[model samples]
Target: MRSKVGLVDLVTRYIIRQKGKKIRPLLVLLSSKLAGGINERSYRGAVLVELLHTATLIHDDVVDNADKRRGLWSINKVFKNKVAVLMGDYLLSRGLMIAVDGKDFDFLGVITNAVKRMSEGELLQIQKTRKLDIDEETYFKVISDKTASLIETCCTIGAMASTQNPELIEALRKYGHSLGMSFQIRDDILDYEGTSSITGKPVGGDIREKKITLPLIYSLNKVSKKEIDSIKKLIKSKNDSVAVKEIISFVKKQNGIEYAYNISRKFAEDAKNALTVFTDSQTKLALESLVDFVTERKN
Candidate 1:
């Protein structure tokens, strides 16, 4: 994957080296195997999913003006914003090329819809953040679009590539969607509970960023109107470290973490239940384990 220019090649290598868990690609392969069998198309599907994921991460870092990713320098941090944006576009185009060259119109449709949903979700979050008005339903909608849609696309593509069973494909899609919801909720929980070393970001990063997640939303609902107003005012303020810490403590005291955990656990359970129709196999077990891992993972 060398480029004609040395700088582009260097940044590409850096990105490859900083790759995260590769969960999307793993879901592609696992779902393919569970549906029927893995083939060249399955491998291509995995590659395309990874390319899409990486491109999104690059763009996200630039959008967030993030300095670090996966505990390493973000592409925008190391290579500057323009180069990072171009590289993200280049990767996205490459992914599209793979789908077009393979004549995988279904996969193309899935990826395009995912990209649209993700963009919409991001814009929605930004809009809500401006008002600090994210409710539980709106938060769920945002996370479903931004995080779960791609995972659903990956599972659907894998099942489509491997088998012709519409039922199986639909089942896997639901499974992926549930798993993705659990995954993101757990990630949000970690923002309040996990260590920076494990999460690769500071605790309460979401609060500092003024992103009202599930825990805070539930906590807000449980508190008095005056307290809720105060919390919103604190979030709308400069979001200083002390204010974020206080908010985190208040959320915990209000049982926000417990409520979020219960909801995430239900989603994880739904994810496991979605695969029950599949014949028992190692792949099925692996997918179930993946559901558990998504909720339990430290990073």
Candidate 2:
């Protein structure tokens, strides 16, 4: 659905055709079942999460000047940047309208906080990217806000919509947060380890973008001061294709990949541990399997 005035509807429809993994909505549904049972409210919450997620992807493509999304032309690439931005705004407003119409004020509050945290995280990353001064603590904070907050919202909203138990909601929130963290760390690792065909982007793309991800961060901490300085110079410089490749190699040689994997595994375990309060059921096992999928996914 789009404006009656122009090509917005067609473009929006095109975007909808390029569907993603729908992981967040799946989480909402699964969490609903885990907490209590699915209902109309659960479906509404899933729709809201998907809408906001799609909006964010539109906006992210514009900001990153991305040409491809999910192996297809990005909205900005096909519709132009201004149209993409307006479409993102349209989707965001539509999501807000759904919450308002449903009178789900509590859900609205959770989503609003997620949006705020995501914005703050993006800005903070941009600021740190200038200096490349990201430490371990800052890294966790950035991922928690930017990547985990919405996942947390999905699980929390799903449980809240279906169940009256505050404890169940809290448990799902923690589960989602830990799973999201592990998910993102795996994504970062893929940037260094996966091929273009597998990841839908060139390996070392993040390094070229000067993104100081967990692997690079862990490697930097382990190397000698001179080695660190050299690596920093390469990152701070133009970061051409060769330099990015070298940086990737250095990270691998320093065992950065292994270090990051270990950390990601720990978070995945924590995610599984969060579900212990629930009784054994197929829905619970599905949630547990999702943890394995997140940590083991190639893309």
Candidate 3:
């Protein structure tokens, strides 16, 4: 992130100071270690994935007009949308340059594909938000592209860095797919029930954004048509605080949270099962532990 520009340096400092969970890079490192051992390519792959993740998050903040990220002011809140958008582009360009300099075409292909999927997923989600009529399949499609693709890329790049064995690479990819699904499902659950102190972000941001998630989807199917319409109206209303509170209560009463937890757990199990390709080792254990952590994380 080094640059002659003073604002670029300043924004770089601001972003690094309060890094989030950093789960993507960790997956990269761990997968590389599990497959063989960490090398220079492993580090490069980690840096590229993290750059893409951060850039997307920065762009997302601008799109959402977000005030905070993690527990602090978002890039848009501090630097305004203009600077934030440019900063995201800067990070992306830096990542591309890094891959080009290293001649890591595999990394470049995976990252470019991820970028495409992320853009499509975000646009689809926006469309669904406007209509507020997302189904379970559509919900999966959104998260699979927007969230899961990033995680899958981490594992993909990492596996490529360590080995050319197609079986091993495919195994890690499958593991990443399920892990990402459970991770986003758990995240959606937290938006409804997580504590502000724990998650940093205020609860019910999804409802405020008019986003329908798995929990609400399951509950909506169980209720009467009249009740469902009323709940939808509450969500669509401009009164965010009241809507958030009422919707949270409604989702909990309808057992949406419980249903979501069960589903996330199943995905977690699937993630673990995918790791059966590798022999038992500390690295394998760590990878499996990540599955539990993603499903059970408070934030």
Model 1, residue 191: displacement in angstroms? 1.0
Q: For model 1, which pairs clash?
A: none
lDDT of 1 by residue, 1-299 (tens): 46698986888889888968888998999999999999988988999999999999999999999999888999999899999999999889888888889888788988999999999999999999989989999999999999999999999999999999999999999999999999999999999899997777899889988999999999999878999999998887785988988999999999999999999999999999999889999899999999888889897
Write one digit per residue (lDDT tens) for candidate 2, span 1-299: 55795687888788878979999999999999999999988988999999999999999999999999988899999989999999998888888888888888888999999999999999888988888889989999999999999999999999998998989999999999999999999999999999888777888888878889999999999989899889988887675887888899999999999999999999999999999999999999999999999999998
Give candidates' CA RMSD values in order.
Answer: 1.0, 1.1, 1.0
Q: What does the lDDT read for residue 269 in candidate 3? A: 98
For every model shown, what is its TM-score relative to the native structure? Answer: 0.98, 0.98, 0.98
**Residue 117, candidate 1: how far off, in angstroms?**
0.5
Better of 2 and 3 by lDDT: 3
Give the Cα lDDT of each candidate.
0.92, 0.92, 0.92
Quote the lDDT for 76 in model 1. Answer: 94
lDDT of 2 at 227: 93
- Roughly what TM-score does model 3 have, to 2 decimal places? 0.98
